[model samples]
Target: MTRCRLCGSTALTSVVDLGATPPCESFLAEDQLDLPEPAYPLHLRVCADCWLAQLPPLIAPEETFREYAYFSSYSTSWVEHARTFVEGAVERLGLGADAFVVEVASNDGYLLRHVVDRGIRCLGVEPSVNVGAVAREAGVPTLTAFLSPETGAAVRGEHGPADLVVANNVYAHIPDVTGFTRGLRALVADDGWVSVEVQHLLTLIEENQYDTIYHEHFQYYTVASAARALASGGLTLVDVELLPTHGGSLRLWARPEGAAGEPTARVAEVLDREKAAGLQELSGYTEFSARVAKVRRDLLRFLVEAAERGETVVGYGAPGKGNTLLNHCGIRPDLLAYTVDRNPYKHGRYTPGTRIPILPPERIAADRPDYVLVLPWNLRTELVEQLSFVHEWGGRLVFPIPELSIVEVTS
Candidate 1:
């Protein structure tokens, strides 16, 4: 029986099957073409008791993120998001110079830089060696290891419990849900709070964002599921806030049970909203597979049509979501000439599974492809503004998911 990760209940049902897929960030090298590609079952299941949407068991964290290619400092929007988060957190938590802040999965110290600038002692826990090196260079005291119960104990012994623990967009990537949350419980000071940010599962299903179904994202969270997960580790969900970043996300505030202020009405409001939206029921995910299948078909048809017309069709963004979409839709060099990314680390590599080369944004301007498919559709507005020059050649931007549509510039 595949028990719920949060409640350990044996009552679970298969909700959506995305088939086998490689790790989205496993970009390949030209010389490594002969290496056998590994693809695992990308099936999602819903826990009846906890309502936590999650993929079936597969790859371990070491295999998934040891040499992670993604660096948070590469994206301007993400950097801005981090800056805003730091400002809000410092003010809301009433943090001062003497208080210590710690962030898990702090890629390139994107968020902690602001914390450090405030004269607050800070630490970052990052598993990826390459990315950790970058964070170290930024003057952030980074521990190059995964966040586990043992690590938490060790960190507490050395630095004492943290006043604030920030885990942005890392909650979903952890496979050992129980151990991870326990680690949070051990590391947070009695009066401290831990804020976890994750892409909302409700938003993912409603927006047809099946492309976010990569191997690394093991669990999809709603307020109820997250509450249950934290409570299991002796933490309480005190508050929840919705954010527009990453399409849609939830910032959950948690603290040790009986440690702080009472749970706010906002927490109940989000839970009630999720339940009303059928997030707690298994039938809520029944239509998700069909919706995603339709997306796959539509995207494939559009790319095939563009190819037959001899029009150059390229992709934008090398995000994990983009890799999932490309691989699922069978996109390759024959269909997409190349993909453009602003990140220097990803520029010269080939996308996993599809093997489409990743080039700099300059390639988009130089090629002026007839169609530039925006893979990270969530960033459409920002990307379109930056690449508006494509309109100079009568080229248009295409969004594949939530339906395929092309946008034309008037000016």
Candidate 2:
């Protein structure tokens, strides 16, 4: 058995078993659909010593992010979230034209674009060449490389330390978070701050977010686990904020050691909340597998009933999480006729494992699917409003996780 990634403990416990699944973001083009694809086990386990839920590193980073399909600017609410965060950070950090900013995994310069517009010197370190090209085109200086201690040192030597290092939804994608956080410390100025956003593990267990589990996301973190990783990287937590994005995420602020960051009360408050909710205990994760199993059964039952009634069912998004859910639940194109997306890149392609046909959102109105499973349930409000025309035929919205729920929509 493999030891825990954060702490080398042989005492690893299973949390949720997602079975074998393909790379969630690896959408197949029409020409590539006939090719054989690889799959990996998607089970999650928690360390008895550190309580960090994790998956083994079967897929290398090079294959996962070389030319990624995910583009941050595609989501409206997400773009708004990034803009609001930049505004807040600029105000709180007192950033100006002289301040230098660095963003790790900065996809398409969605947030750094705001910083550049403010005249603050900004740079982005992106691993995906395809995504980095888009950022470079947007006038955001981007380096097509992964963040590491060596890479961090090189950037610091040439460009000097940064006042702010932004990491949003990138930590989970990384296998060596200890090394990644160390790179964040190596690149930031002595008095500068490192802000990281990760999907909260508490939300995963509570909201039945099994869909979020994939090979790319190697680790799941609670505040306790995250603080441990950051501390290992020579940083100290100063503040933590809960976000509604990505089901629920935690935005943690940290500073270099001996810099006197004086953590906010929210730090202890959230820790206490996690302890109160049993997140700090191994037993808390034991019941989660059963909770996730219930969801799989329920979703399968819903799809089967819909098909038996001679109703059409389709999906709304092609997010990585959606692929995990569909593959885990054994959903096929037979039950779900096809899925639609607003991103033209995903059009004319098929989901990784489920192989559900991908089409434009216009297909939803033309076919008028009786049930539209909102694949990205976290963005249900935005998708529902955008797809309000579905109400013309009394089309219903389905949320499979957090207990299968059917919602009625009005135009």
Candidate 3:
């Protein structure tokens, strides 16, 4: 029996099967489209002991993120979100010029740049050479190395332990949660705070967000599973805030054991909600595979019927979630002609497996696709506003996850 990554339990249950999917971020150059792209099994499992829904390691971090293509600065809303976090963190944590801040997986210094502007000392540890260079260019003092206990200790030796450690949207991507959390303890001061943001498992299940599952995302966490992972690595969960990001994400604030503060009611309240939602039991995860299958079938039917009606469909964002939905349903250029992304790094590249071309968002205004499938549904409100001009041509927008909904727009 394979051991669970969180609890080391051999008792695991299947959650959802996405078949084989290529690494979502592996966009191809024009000349490389003919080359064979590798796909790996995307079988997700939930640990019976800890109820952590996880995808077993299918690809290595070096293959997926070392030369990462995704850049955080491409999205305005996401950058604003990071700034909001930094502003609140500064006020709440009493961060000032003397305070030191460190961020793990700080893509392009999107969040840490705000801290630097305040004259606070900050550093970013990013493994991806592509984006790490961007962070350094932005004067955020980024290190091109993965964040492990060794790296954390070395960084701490050079510059004293950080007063604030930020690890946002990283918990899901890292394969070794145990080692990472332990490294987090080493990175922060005993009296300092560490904040980790991860998409909640409850949201993934209830919202039919199976599209969020991909090779890079190794695990999904409920509040309970997350607490357990942190506890094992010498940290104590002090507070949790449920934020309306990435469908829904929980920002967990933890502290080293010796410096652990009083627990907040928010922690218990969220855990109770998860239990009431049946996430504490193994049975909660068993029914998700059926929901996932329905989503795939429904999306395929919609795309197929739209094609028959001579309605053209195109995609909006080149997000990781979109890649999962595309490959799992086997959607190709026939269904979605091409996708538009705000990121120049992804523009001109072809999506892995499906081989759909990626272009800039500016292309949407010129082409005027009949139905624009919004792949990053979490940003539907923002995307809808930005692409509202499509209404002039009587075009509609399609949302596939949670359910298939066709939204018509008027100019």
Candidate 4:
């Protein structure tokens, strides 16, 4: 933390301090509830040299991912998103049966299954043993190991150089950004394409999506800074696409420096947008802490008022981001009652710090709470339809990010 993780610079400035919270995905079992829990400083800082927004590497990847609780297949919309990405990648990269594809941190084979269907050889390098087992059971060729320069080289040697390397929603998870990017280089063919999807810092600040900040995500990247990180591993940013997933994300296309020609116009366009948003300078970040404070205040006020009015407020989706929001707001079972999730693994567990009980999604219908707080608000569209049954009991849904808003479901 003394030096920037990306640039090794000591000139790091505070972005926002979210106090301290437990690791976002560390759900506690019933027996462990009475034991002491651990928390870390959830403060975010920006590197003055590289403009990369990041948190200190308080927790190691091995501590969190070895036996992960998150299963990507639980989210129907995310599964569909993976399917679409595979189809597009096949077409965009002219991949065929001869093509070799690799996905880093491929959870539960949610994405590479599509590659398998198309007869393209694919491999998933995942760090989590439990989730990697599920991927192997589902027929994905998975290696239960974390991605690193050595791991990547071993994969390339054993499986042959990959034609396409896909890393989705994992670019920000590693504390060693430069090393991880080098791993990507080692796995991919000299002329092969590398695609990475990460939450865009610009949208994170503009949309008031501070809840996404957690220990798991070591760094947040704008295209400008991302390009610099990619260069450290000899990868050149070729094209950029703005994606709607993970609130707002960037799909960066990169290649080995020798094969990467000039970057696409879209890359310049996105960089211009980032600069215009004041991200390259300190101006854009100056007011983010105040806005984040306002969000916390507004959400706490609503929950407090709901309690006073004798209205029941429960949460939906025990996602990692939801844990950050709940812990930061200091919400416990008293204010939230209990939350429901589609993931069976979390049904009987409690959220890490807040200790909110996680029940099956059907519990909402069985108990019919007055308000269902939508924690994974990024999946709002898909969840609304899934929870439309709330309309039967005149129940409404609540969203806390991008400002708090409530919507009454109609049958």
Best by lDDT: 4
TM-score (C-alpha) between model 2 and the true structure: 0.98
Task: Return the lDDT, model 3, position 314.
Answer: 91
Better of 3 and 4 by lDDT: 4
For each candidate in turn, the TM-score is 0.97, 0.98, 0.98, 0.99
| Model 1 lDDT per residue over 167-271, tens place | 899999987888999898888998889999999998888888888888899899998888888887778999999988777899999998979578899988988
Report residue 121 deviation for candidate 1 (angstroms). 0.7
Instruction: Name the runs in model 3 displaced over 4 angstroms.
Output: none
Instruction: Supply every candidate's count of residue pairs whose N, Cα or C atoms clash at under 3 angstroms.
Output: 0, 0, 0, 0
Q: How well is each residue in 1-411 modelled by candidate 3, as lDDT tens digits?
A: 298988888988888788998898888899997788788999888888888888888687878778998899887889999999999999999998899999999989989899888999999999999899999898899999888999999999999999999999998888889999988988999999999999999999999999999989999999999999999888999999999899999999999999887889999999999999889887677788898889999999999999999989999999988999999999999999999998888889999889999998888889888999999999877888887899988889999979999998765
Per-residue C-alpha lDDT of model 2 across residues 1-411, encoded as one tens digit per residue: 489888898989888888999999999988887899899998899898888889999998889899898999999999999999999999999998899999999999999999988999989999999999999999999999999999999999989999999999998988888899999999999999999999999999988898999988999889999999999899999999999999999999999988846789999999998888888777688888888889999999999999999999999989999999999988999899999988888999999988899999888888888999999999977987887787899999998878899988888
The regions of model 1 sitting more than 4 angstroms off are none
Order of candidate numbers by lDDT, starting with the best: 4, 2, 3, 1
Q: lDDT at 350 for candidate 4? A: 97
Cα deviation of 7 in candidate 3 (Å)?
A: 1.9
